[model samples]
Target: MTGGPSRGARGGRAWREGHAAEWIAALWLMLKGYRILGFRLKSRAGEIDILARRGRVLAVVEVKRRKTMQAALAALTPHQTARLVAAAQQVVRGRKALQALEIRLDLVALAPGRFPRHRRGVGA
Candidate 1:
């Protein structure tokens, strides 16, 4: 059997798709009353896809572009989870007002042309 797309070709497509997904998700969040605080926030620990807020609620969201929920969930490796938690803590520590606000971890899994599957209040 012949190899399909080369590694570079596949990677380029995936990168483009991921950016598209992020833009779509960001727009969706804006429409849903969430104020976008940061996009692609990174620390030594890890990167947070999106950080948005609704009132006093601080949300750490992971945006996944996947064909299925299983595929999306699979992307959240244990190491990533740890880093997400650490980054969230760092965010909270920096702002006293935000620190008192209830923190929520969420997942937004996007499948092409479909409603994003949002899982809210995820814990470590």
Candidate 2:
């Protein structure tokens, strides 16, 4: 049964890749003047890739990694976007700190040989 790496190993590799992508996305967001509040934040609805704030705005970010920019953008499906939006709302509902800030959905797309693409106000 040693034809190739096992399913668990593949999943571990994917997890590592996603982790690195999230770190890159977080750094990029910081560079753009956002203070990172959470990374890999789990909510009752779903997992939030990153939560960041700047001035009076709070950003709920979704990170996607793919072979190309188009593919990365396409990775964020409508269903996932809905889940992210719901998760953001559910997670922020009880937090007074975030309640005062304007909330927005953001995307950080990672592709090989290119800078991370950050798009604000996505899926709004």
Runs off by more than 4 Å, candidate 2: none
Index of the highest-TM-score prediction:
2
**What does candidate 1's lDDT look like per residue over 1-124, in tens digits?**
3679988899999999988888788888888899888888877667788998998888898888888766875676666667888998887787776788777888778876578777777654
Question: Candidate 2: what lDDT?
Answer: 0.92
lDDT of 2 by residue, 1-124 (tens): 8899999999999999999999999999999999999998888889999999999988999999999999997788888889888898887897977888888989999998999999998887
- TM-scores, each model vs. reference: 0.83, 0.94
Candidate 1 wrong stretches, greater than 4 Å:
1-3, 73-75, 95-97
lDDT of each: 0.81, 0.92
Top lDDT: which candidate number? Answer: 2
State the local distance difference test value for candidate 1. 0.81
